[model samples]
Target: MSGHACGSLRHACAALAVLASIGAGTAAAQQISPAETLLFETEHLARVRVPATLVYAFRKESNVEPGFKDEVRLELAKVNGKLNATLHFLTGVHKQDIPALEEAHGNPVLLGFLEHDIAEMKRLTGGSTAYFRKRIRMALAEGAQVSLQPITYQGKTVQAQAVRIQPYLNDPMHARFEKYLRKTYTFILSEQVPGSLYQLHSSLGKPETVRTGTQPADAPVIDETLTLISVTPKQP
Candidate 1:
């Protein structure tokens, strides 16, 4: 893997850790419903093939153009009742690897960055209702606004849920290290297509330069969008 890939992976891991820590305090407050369990089980065990394209746009500053465009082809399939996904980065910077199949007890719909294990997979896939519930609670506690609205993606419309988290740091001891951050996540899903994720859009207030000490002195806001290009459901 190139240095950029390594750095991106590391940053993702760190963000996951921070999210986990934030939810740790409210873990006991969460309730799992039978409906959620059934949905999770059905989705994880479903025989289907999902082929999607992930487009990543990197902008250093507002005035400057995007630094580069990266495209990755993601293939998700269930083989012998095991769920697995293969991510092929067409850019040729990173080697193609097939992550091991594991029980999707946490995140049924694969949405986030592809990882090897279930825990990491859950962290990477951020569209889980349970995960968003935790974030909603935290945002509400912090006096942030949450909303739900209908949104369109790739000519398909779906209801999108979002939460805006203000600039707040949790750990007082590490306040200095933590930069003022504002984040907004929009999750798009179709009720007609259960056990699947349609799209996810995330916006960050701070710039990429602040997180990664690279060039482009000014803070450039970062935006990411993940969409499902097509799905082929297998008949039982």
Candidate 2:
């Protein structure tokens, strides 16, 4: 009952800042794009009520390796009146170290996903972790494309933004993983959504096979997404 709805486009523009706490360079130092602001700087989770569980359905499919149908759970709660989060990035036997996020940092989902993705890239490509990390950071900071979009939330249409990028296409070392050159990412965010993030999608392989989504693992490509499937009051 506390969050505003249907207008994140304007809220993002109004909330613009370098948000250096998340490693944003000062505004005077360089040009930061809207993609960067929304992804790294905006408080995406502040509006979701404390004691809520934001459930994201994580689906990954690939012809080259084993795939998974899993979930990412964000347990949101209050700590001294400020929002806090615990990200369960992976559960069950493959569980990762629990990440207790910064108080009111507001975008833990993005942080957690990219961290896991970077590791996956390195594991699959035999690439340096630093390379994947830096390229992704640079793309968001200055190179991604942004567009206004409409998204559905609770049966109503609302304004949102989609930020798209392919960070490896121009990398000098990209030939190291030739087939991955066309990897692209799309992230959709809307204020009307409980946690602001509507979806995070990553596509890899030929354009033809890249469009494969959640249910199709038999394709010769890799497709993955973390979609905001539900949000509900947490059991106390």
Q: How good is model 1 by TM-score? A: 0.49
Q: For candidate 2, what is the lDDT?
A: 0.71
The residue ranges of model 1 lying beyond 4 angstroms of the native Cα positions read 1-26, 29-66, 88-91, 94-98, 102-111, 114-146, 163-180, 193-195, 205-217, 232-236
Among all windows of 10 consecutive residues in model 1, the one with the lowest summed lDDT is 56-65
Displacement of the residue 47 alpha carbon in candidate 1, Å: 8.6
Error of 1 at 16 (Å): 4.2
Error of 2 at 30 (Å): 0.5
**lDDT by residue (tens digit), candidate 2, 131-169:** 777677667766799999998766678999999999888
- What are the models' TM-scores? 0.49, 0.80
Per-residue accuracy of model 1 over 81-103 as CA lDDT, tens digit each:
65455545334543334343342
Lowest lDDT sum, 10 consecutive residues, model 2, at 1-10
lDDT of 2 at 109: 74
* Best candidate, TM-score: 2
RMSD of each: 10.7, 7.3
CA lDDT of each candidate? 0.38, 0.71
